[model samples]
Target chain A: MTHPAEIKALVFDVFGTIVDWRSGVARGAAAFLDRYAPALDPYAFADAWRAEYSPSMEEIRSGRRRYVRLDVLHRENLVRTLDRYGIVDVPDADIDALNLAWHRLDPWPDAVAALHRLKRRFIIAPLSNGNIRLMVDVAKRAGLPWDAILGAEVVRAYKPSPQVYSDTVEILSVAPAELCLVAAHNGDLAAARRLGLSTAFVLRPTEHGPGQTTDLQADDAWDFDVKDLNELADRLGCPD
Target chain B: MTHPAEIKALVFDVFGTIVDWRSGVARGAAAFLDRYAPALDPYAFADAWRAEYSPSMEEIRSGRRRYVRLDVLHRENLVRTLDRYGIVDVPDADIDALNLAWHRLDPWPDAVAALHRLKRRFIIAPLSNGNIRLMVDVAKRAGLPWDAILGAEVVRAYKPSPQVYSDTVEILSVAPAELCLVAAHNGDLAAARRLGLSTAFVLRPTEHGPGQTTDLQADDAWDFDVKDLNELADRLGCPD
Candidate 1:
């Protein structure tokens, strides 16, 4: 087992790891749909909208488009998804409000308390694909006690790009070995591990819904494998 | 007086505005000198070291050097100052620690409490020249409750360059008029004002020491002028 003594900071993958984005988005979409397109299935609407997340980022990653902040991309994706559902003529204000639903995600039950505990001993922050504004709004809404805001916007490059991890390490002024990347997804952890950063996996069995087959548990021999954030904090020796 | 209702975020100038860098550096220098060079005048050393700050940043601003983080600039400036004072041969670790004294700056007496009050109503952060690591360290040490970190490294540009202020506004996803730049220095507020951001001036008479002649009071027709952060918070309608 790797010792947690030297880790000075823990950067998190925000969407599913810290907040229940799936449930939050579904709830918000349902409310919006209930008011407008009452016949639409809100859960399917949310899942389809989320399905576009990576492809939207891939456009910038492949240099097919200039880098746009996540908020703009979210708005664009929302419009396209609404079009696919035969829902049109949505007011700009309503569309903007629905797009900001990403910022108001509710943290998992254990997230806030565990993060407060972790924060007492380590610098805690989100290294998400979300831009600074989205992350800031999430932090405020969800009561995440972040020591700093870091993400693709700061480096102007998305994750899985070596630049994102390298820039985070540089900006934090810590060696890769002295920082830990905590995520529910194996891919995020794998990338951090490849870059020589320590990795911790916290299982989120239903992250992609009950049928999720992948990342139901740690897939790689990460530095730490914990059931939840509280356990991760305990493993890191943060006081209860 | 400008209404505070529209302002959603408050971005600060860190060094002289929030933290008393001059006194903090002097205290840290005195401690270092007591062990290594007891005869040295620590205040003069601290002042001489700070005197290099603007010029060091000017190198990057003028494109004479690539953009480097503030910690790196502080280290280089420390080395040159030590050499000028005929003090050399310090251990690399000691020099590094001494350079990081900038990260241990003490917030002004009213800073923490006032910031807590203001944070309830507005998103408060340091839009500083200091990089993320330095800002995070200072926040941890000084108990400044910053909502997010925004600064030079995040934008890859220094203050007074229109890019820094503009990038910050874009990242916060707020209109220039909807964000406020609060600083002790007129130059910072002036730059922000030129870019259409609201500005607040808080007096920090001893920021450059008791003999300070500049920035003793608001020098422009700033949107708000007050004696301290507490007064600024009061004026902003943040509950006491």
Candidate 2:
């Protein structure tokens, strides 16, 4: 965890780390539900939709299903979440557009500038569970300056699975310790650290919206623990 | 062959299409030769080094060898090419750096600006034989505004192979016709076209220097045949 100077690239976790998915999804869902289930809580809808993310990926991670893109998984989860709310009769096109809510997420206020600062020194990319198309859409919409997109789809495995961590490092052709995984989730950091990668934790108090109890702080020691990406950039000696 | 409005992503073929590898490699070889074989023609040296590219890839394309990165192939070819030149006793570090000459190739003058204009209208990425790291290095140094990098290593297959075309289109999550391949080489276009991807032939007349004969003219009818990336951008109706 101490080889700071040796870190050549910093790969990020996207969902709650780079972009505020819950807020964006809620906003998108607000507009979406206004035309459908006006009484449904958009935030609850966002939470409900997100609630299905892990268990759906668990099927693929557990080898019960073959690898598929995140978009496919998201669409599947959206249907299931809709049924949970008893919402029906949504047009296919509307459902498709709503699924892309993930693509339009707004970055943390400090994320973009700090990412540009970090990009000036290190190779920066998303090491998210999102697929390449999803990463590209989010980067284009949010102006995230990524050198490349690397994630679960590239290696056909999701995070915390050993393959996701190892295959991503291998794809980069760098020493495991030389690629840092910057995430808001301690479990993600722990998995990456377990795989010989360096780790940095960015504290996001309301990643799941307050009273969110998880990943609000660094749960364990990390190479760099900071309040935001700006602090992470500053800690790594990137220019302001 | 005429789905102009449908093209959502413009994936490029990098070597002769985006960058002037012959000139850049010859230039790099010239600087390297100043320390060693000043008697050898840098252009000849460049061509000789490039001579191994197809055969090396053919090994993988034919399924006779396991998939390896272009960097690895380049390093192996470097030693062979050096022996062909009867040059030896070079330090491994220097050889390693020289092998990375692929990383430092200069983009054609019109490429970066044209790519920027194209990026505004579509997702732009490299669909090259070069590996991801090589694409990233070239883009960073040359200021190529790629939305992502997609190529041989990403699909673990070389160009003109079915997977190289189908898989890249699949990776972009675009319909084959919705992804346009802008390349200088006709055979590359031919292969892409065969797979139902749209193709544009950007003529790079002097890719092999003044005596360049091949690919100076479009070999077959393509979706768009133009003078350079600038013209290709114009043909695609991208803004100035």
Candidate 3:
């Protein structure tokens, strides 16, 4: 195992690792559906909308489409999801607000407190696919105490891309090995580890809802494995 | 005057406006000089180093050199300043720390508290030439609570450049008019105003020392003229 002493910064995967986006989006979708398409199942609607996230990013990742902020992608996905659900005629204003639901995600129960503790010992920021505005809005609303906003927007590329991790390391002025990427997603950690960044696998078994099968456990021999951010903080010897 | 009510984000010029860099740099230089070059005047050393800032940036802005982070520029400037002061043979480590003096700058007396107040109402960030790492370090050390670090590094250009303000506006996802650029420098505000952003002129008469002549007061008809950040917050209707 790599020594934790070298880790000076901890960049998190935000969507599900730090925030309970599944539940947050479900709640937000429920409110929108109630106001627009009351008969729809908000949970299914949220899952469908979220299911489009990766594929949308894939287009940019594969260079098939130009890069746009996650907010823009989320808006496009929202429109497509609405059509898929056979719900139309939603006002542009309401649709805009619904798109911003990604910005209002709630933290997992232990995320905020743990982040505050970790911030005392490490530079903590999101290294997710979320754009600067979306991350800033989420940080402000969810009380995420980020030292700086770092992510896809800053690098102009989505996560799992070498550019994202490399750019974050360059921005932080830290060696890749001196930075740790914390995530509940195996793919994120895998990509980070391949780029020589330290990796911490955070278990968020219910991230994709109760039946979530993938990333329920650390797939690789990550540098650290912890149940939540708080445990990760404790293992890193952060002061309360 | 433009209405302050439309402003959604408040992007600041950090060095002379939020933090008293002159005093902070002088203090940091004194400590370093005391250990290495005891006979040197730290205040003069600080001024000499700062004097190189604009010219170094101009090189990048004019495309005489490719973009480099402010930290890198500061390091190069530090070595030249030390040589000019006849203080050579300093270890690379000490020189590196001295270059980071910019990151340890102390905020103006009312800056932090006023920022907290303004933060309750607006998205406050440092839109300075300082790179993300420098800004993050300064924010952490000085307790300046910023919503995001948006500046020269993020845009890969120095201030007074259209890319800096335009990219910042794009990142904040706010219309140019909906963002306010707050600074103690007339040139900065003038550049921002030309980009259609609301401008707030802050007074920092002693920024370049007691004899400081420029930017002593508002030069143009700014949208808001305030004595300090506290007054700026009050004029913007931020909570006490």
Candidate 4:
């Protein structure tokens, strides 16, 4: 949807759309533990840890468990990933500090610039599943310029859940048609689209590293399709 | 409380602490239709509208009504205040537009500079009763540099409600003592302190009006008591 003055708010799906989390976590992990596990393939370790994310959140989304913040989930996943990799006896304090890697992820090359431009026009924020603290860290460290952080902790549910999108838009006081979700994930955009939230897809070709098989292109008729946030800014008429 | 690196989050009470809402609404109301209510005391109109605030929120805080966003409450108060002043037949749209004066408030002069300095040191956010949209507008327009907006709607209750304080601190994943609330009103700080949240009293002697009778001095031994945000920032070791 065009970002005319009336387009009240635009929410983003953060992980792959705004930041390259895989590379970011890999780098952070390597920095934290290259000496402890010299044979560790950092990128593979990043994938292994991330693999735990969905199932843990699914437990909550399915009502089998109550809501827990992403920071807790990330640390839990971290411990399990370390065990599988035979990295043992790491100090709890060290583990806790390393878990903040999620908070320090690097935004996409186009993200900060595009978001700054968009901020001048739209009430832009993240509707990611990351908890409020997580979103706040990522925005501060990456210069995201979000007006507020909204997601899992606020709504007590994970993404793709209808309430995650619906309740978030309600908090921003924007109708579904006036709220847009820009993401690299079709599943997320499709969920948002089902609830009448406008959608934009940005290609993150290497999000899962070179052999990435999913979300390489806009597979559905999203409201807008772009290669990156810069293109999104252009489409939304944000000037250079 | 000292704002060392350990002070994880500093949540602000926005209305009088950060912004001047009374003069703001008065200006907007006068501009919206000065001819219709030429004899209207703009400041009194502001006070009349604000007088309904606590009683309305008290309904929710007392569990007699469900939580409502501050924007809705403000609009409701505005309509009632207008009727009391003998203004009639104003369209709903104009009232709605004028009610947004809360979103356009001018920050206390020290707020922006001090907050910018404080932002570099702490995770600063507003823990006001304003809804996400209203906080977003106020922060965006006033350049308050908040890391996130955490408040009433997010907690699903208005302030002085223990949940409002407890839940907001939980969102930041900080211990109660690690989160400091800086507000102009002694009562707000007192409520925060009751729940083990650290408190700072920034004196806004004129928050209610020139002859404001309450909260003129720190009534309790708050963790930190100062005359303004600049002094608060200074005591916290944020450099000029």
Which predicted model would earn the best DockQ?
1
**lDDT by residue for model 2 (B1-240), tens:** 676788999999999999999988888888788787889998999999999999999999999999999999999998999998889898998899888888999999899899999999999999999998888999999999899989898889999898999998888888999999999999999999999999999999988889888998888989999998888778788889
Give the alpha-carbon lDDT of every model. 0.90, 0.91, 0.91, 0.88
Cα lDDT, model 1, residue A135: 90
Candidate 3 residue lDDT tens string, B23-111: 89999888898988898878788899999999999999999999999999999999888888788789899998888889899999999
- How much does each candidate deviate from the true structure in C-alpha RMSD? 1.2, 1.4, 1.4, 1.8
- Per TM-score, the best of the predicted structures is 1
Better of 1 and 3 by TM-score: 1
User: TM-scores for chain A, candidates in order?
Assistant: 0.97, 0.98, 0.97, 0.96
Candidate 4 at A238: error in angstroms? 0.9
Q: For model 1, name the residue pairs that clash.
A: none
Clashes of each: 0, 0, 0, 0
Per-prediction DockQ, in order? 0.84, 0.75, 0.80, 0.81
Docking class of 3: medium
CA displacement after TM-score superposition, residue B162 of candidate 1 (Å):
1.0
The TM-score between candidate 4 and the true structure equals 0.95
Q: Looking at candidate 4, what TM-score does chain B attain? A: 0.96
Shift of residue B42 alpha carbon in model 3, Å? 0.8
Q: Compared with the true structure, what per-residue lDDT tens digits does model 1 show for residues B1-240? A: 457888999999999999999989998898899887899887888899999999999999888898999998999999999898888789999998899889899999999999999988888889999989999999988889899999898889899888899988988988998999999999999999988899999999999887999998888899999999999898889999
- lDDT, model 4: 0.88
Candidate 2 per-residue lDDT over residues A9-120, each given as its tens digit: 9999999999999999999899889988999889999999999999999999999999998899999999999988888888899999999898889998888999999998
Query: Can you write out model 3's per-residue Cα lDDT over A1-240, one digit (the tens) per residue?
Result: 778898999999999998989888898888889877888887778889999999999999988988999999999999999998888888899999888888889999999899999998899999989999889889999899999889998888998889899889989989999999999999999999888999999999998887887898888899999998889988999888
TM-score of each: 0.98, 0.97, 0.97, 0.95
Error of 4 at A44 (Å): 0.8
Q: After superposition, how far is residue A117 of candidate 2 from its true place, in Å?
A: 0.7
Quote the lDDT for A151 in model 2: 86
